[model samples]
Target: MELYRKTLTSATWWSLVIFNLLTFSSCKNQPESTVPSWKIKLIANSTSHVTYLVDLERAIDHILRVQLVQVPVFKGKELIVLQNIMALLDNFNPLYKYKKGKANIKNINRFIKSQTEVSQEYFKGLANDDEFATENYIGDDYIGCLGSQSGLRGFNCSLWNLFHYWTVQSSFSPELFQPGAVLWTLHGYVHHFMNCSECYLNFWFYVQEHQIEDVKTHDEEILWLWRAHNYFNRKLAGDVTEDPWFPKKQFPEDKYCRKCRWKGKWQNDKVLKYLKNIYSSISEVVGLINKEEEP
Candidate 1:
């Protein structure tokens, strides 16, 4: 009986030791799953309104690519032109004025000149034996030029007409080209099209008018915009709700539901318009190009 009891105790001790060893070994060997984190930072300063989207601790790498590498390669002169326009616009801001530092207007002009040269060279290479005019210049001829034929001309003309009617012969000036004004103008264009399904359908037709090759299919673009629209909506709304850091209280004036009403309305309107126009244009151009190829 003594021997049996001793044997039973020995077995129990050995079992407990083995169990503990197994548990420790399992825990030590277990792999950890990493979750990806995305961070979007909006930097609105005197000279630039920069929006940076990146993973945490990876901002420097992303910024280097965006500001130094990708912008030069992908956009080149177009980026410089945009930067110049943004800088000019930034100077007019009452809150923050752009200051010309080491890179003055001359530097900007030089950059623009360089970009134009690069663009011309690029076009020349593409033209090859064919005449330059024969090649499809959707963006270059139709969109880039300031002439009446340009789409931007049409957009600006429509905006000016609307603004003039509303304001009763308000003198048109560059001062009117504020970000808020631009946003409203874009909103109006979107609202106008969306209200008319036929016009909206026609808007896609107009995009097809551009006839860009290498453009995304209409269905694919629509799907992408739909996804993006939903994502932004969810992200912003979630930020408003889930983030304990954001203020929840109403202000003293609290006019327009403490600005939340305005925000929600504008956000939805702007996002929808942006998505619609981009998708419509891309789809239209691709469809047009494909149709032309078929015959």
Candidate 2:
């Protein structure tokens, strides 16, 4: 009887040990999630801001394409390009007009609405007038002249010229002129703009949390992004100019020489300094965060 009882006690102890081992092994073998939980939390807490950032990034890409490449060419036949440019500008107008209260987007929103109405009317007029299209297509110069005569101003002219030039010079398929790319690029700009706006909004929230009344203005935030964008632009230009393939091509003495020299020297140096300033600001913010983390 004593031996049987001892045997039973040993079996029970061994069984308990096996159960614990199995449990631990199961835990150890379980697959860990790949996604960062902290990022998820941050996103969840600031969903609107995140969306805004993404849109602003998209917008920035569109803006860069328009300013650096498209606008410079400005030939005449590309109606789609012009439409896309106008659409993007319209989309971003709201950000510029943000106010403190009562929906805060009065000025820009009004401007966009008016522009949209005008664009719709213009398209309707175009559809009705076959003669207008025939007269406009004689040549690049004629098309540009007609567009200007049509009283389309500002970014509209810039957009019209870019695609027109591309169409005149390149053998690209007509389908390539579809406005979808413009929409997608504009989305990037909107993403970046929203990101910037959220950064400011977050700063404002932080200020409020600390009971601080003073806050940076929206203009200041826009200027900050503009400066950053310009810095990046110069960096990209410098990279291109420094390439062995670039400077070898003979440039026009009257136009390209001075511009290339400036790009290589003063502009590149200034951009580097601007980028350094941005880095310094970021480092200071990081240091503050680290200090706060210290218990």
Give the clash total for candidate 1.
2
- In candidate 2, stretches whose alpha carbon ends up further than 4 angstroms from where it belongs are 1-49, 53-58, 61-70, 91-94, 98-295
Question: Per-residue lDDT for 135-231 in model 2, tens only?
Answer: 2221122111111112211132223223222222111222333322332222232222112211223123322332111213322222232332233
Steric collisions counted per model:
2, 30
The lDDT for every candidate, in the order shown, is: 0.25, 0.27
Best candidate (score: TM-score): 1
Per-candidate RMSD, Å: 28.9, 29.2
Off by over 4 Å in 1: 1-69, 74-106, 117-235, 239-243, 247-295
Lowest lDDT 10-mer window, candidate 1?
Answer: 37-46
Q: After superposition, how far is residue 175 of candidate 1 from its true place, in Å?
A: 5.4
